[model samples]
Target: MGEVTAVAQALPPWVLVVIAAAVGVKYLGQALAEGSEQWARILGPLGRRWRSRAERRTEKEAADLVALQRQVENLSVEVERLTARDKKRGEFEEKLREYLVYDANWHFRAQLAAAGAGTTLPDHMSFAQWEASRP
Candidate 1:
């Protein structure tokens, strides 16, 4: 009983309070540091996975854009080819019309010569008389 009482009296109240506070603060700091490290460990993989997915999405978008550009270029070439073909077709049709008109004129002239050679009528007959004389 005497030893316990002496020890209790030798320990100052202020010193005990300071020691308790220091221990509490040290434990709290250790707990906070450990918690922060654990949180980082848990979230590290998730952050890396999210970044990977974003990179894949960006690559897909870039590929799509490249494909679209290629398609547009192909379409433009097709349009140019079609325009050239149409222009050529138009020119061919115009030439065909001229050939047809020339052929008709040649046939008419040949028939007129045949009629003039077969008949004694003057070659100066009007179109109406020529039609009337046709058998």
Candidate 2:
């Protein structure tokens, strides 16, 4: 206590006031910085919550786009498959039309009956066999 008093008495009054002001300014700046940091911490979660929702929405949109693209690709493949099947069916119809024969006298039915065929009964004969079996 005696040493502190001696130091205070030795220093000029203006120097003491300058030191006191410097200490006060330093503490004030430190307090402001700490308060600003606390406010940032308090608001940080709210900012993050809004950002997270926006990010989730963006991700969902991207997923929907991918699913739509996949569906379009699947639809394109199905259309191609159906088109090919229709073309094959048309070709087969044309071939069968060429192979079929008609008679005005209707003797072709008699020929089929002569070849062990029956009326209203299924037969194990292919088109080529039935054509050949005509007597």
Candidate 3:
């Protein structure tokens, strides 16, 4: 190795470097050039088309999201309105139930009074007393 290095050092460094570069260029330069040419031919137009389509798709998605947001806002407003109406109806229904309870109680008292006043019950007691005693 030392002898080889001594011989190499005896020569001019640029000559050895140039010989190495020429050998590498002979073996690998053609493959590198062909690869670059194929890349330009096959991928250049396809890459442009792909990028344009991607941009258009993103634009469409943005538009759809905006429309959906508007629809959601409208639906939220409608739901709030309907809920308010339902609350009002529920209040009215509660009032109606309260009135019906009061009216039924009054009607039952009136019937009890009429039965007491209009008839003579047996055994010095009313029919209700007799029924109550049996149960």
Candidate 4:
């Protein structure tokens, strides 16, 4: 490769220009014989038509990305709302259970108090004896 470069550098600039022109002409002649298909194939994305097509594809992809992002955001909000509702429901259930326990305790104590009231002893032993003797 070094030897080739040295040989190329030794050549006159005009010789290089002529060689380049010949190559260009050869390709141009081939393109002309092959018609527009050859030109379109060689130009590929460099052509204006291909560029516009690429731009349209990019725009469509961007729009799709935006739509997907919006869907993700909406789903996140929905998840947060559901999580909050679940938390609130749990708190309410806990409070209801506490109230039920308190109500049960109150009712049990009332029953005990009522039973004790019925079995109350008289202040005087004579009164107690008379009450017991009557029944």
Candidate 4 global lDDT:
0.73
Cα lDDT tens digits, model 3, 45-98, are 644454455557779999999999999999999999999999999999999889
Report how far residue 66 has shifted in candidate 2, in Å: 0.5
Model 3 has an lDDT value of: 0.72
lDDT of 4 by residue, 22-59 (tens): 99976665554344544645665444355455557779
TM-score of each: 0.52, 0.42, 0.49, 0.50
Q: Write the per-residue lDDT of candidate 2 for residues 5-92, one digit (tens) a residue.
A: 9999999999989999999965655444344555334446644444455567779999999999999999999999999999999999
Candidate 4: where is the Cα deviation over 4 Å? Answer: 1-47, 119-135
> Can you list the residue pairs that collide in candidate 3?
none
Model 4: how far residue 127 lies from native, Å: 44
lDDT of 1 by residue, 1-135 (tens): 999889878999897799899999656554443445553344466444544555677799999999999999999999999999999999999998899689668767877887888944334544468689999
Error of 3 at 14 (Å): 37
lDDT of all the models against the reference? 0.73, 0.70, 0.72, 0.73
Better TM-score candidate (3, 4) = 4
Weakest 10 consecutive residues, lDDT, candidate 1?
Answer: 32-41
The residue-level lDDT of candidate 2 at 21 comes to 100
Q: How high a TM-score does candidate 3 get? A: 0.49
Return the lDDT, model 1, position 60.
Answer: 100
- Backbone N/Cα/C clashes per model: 0, 0, 0, 0
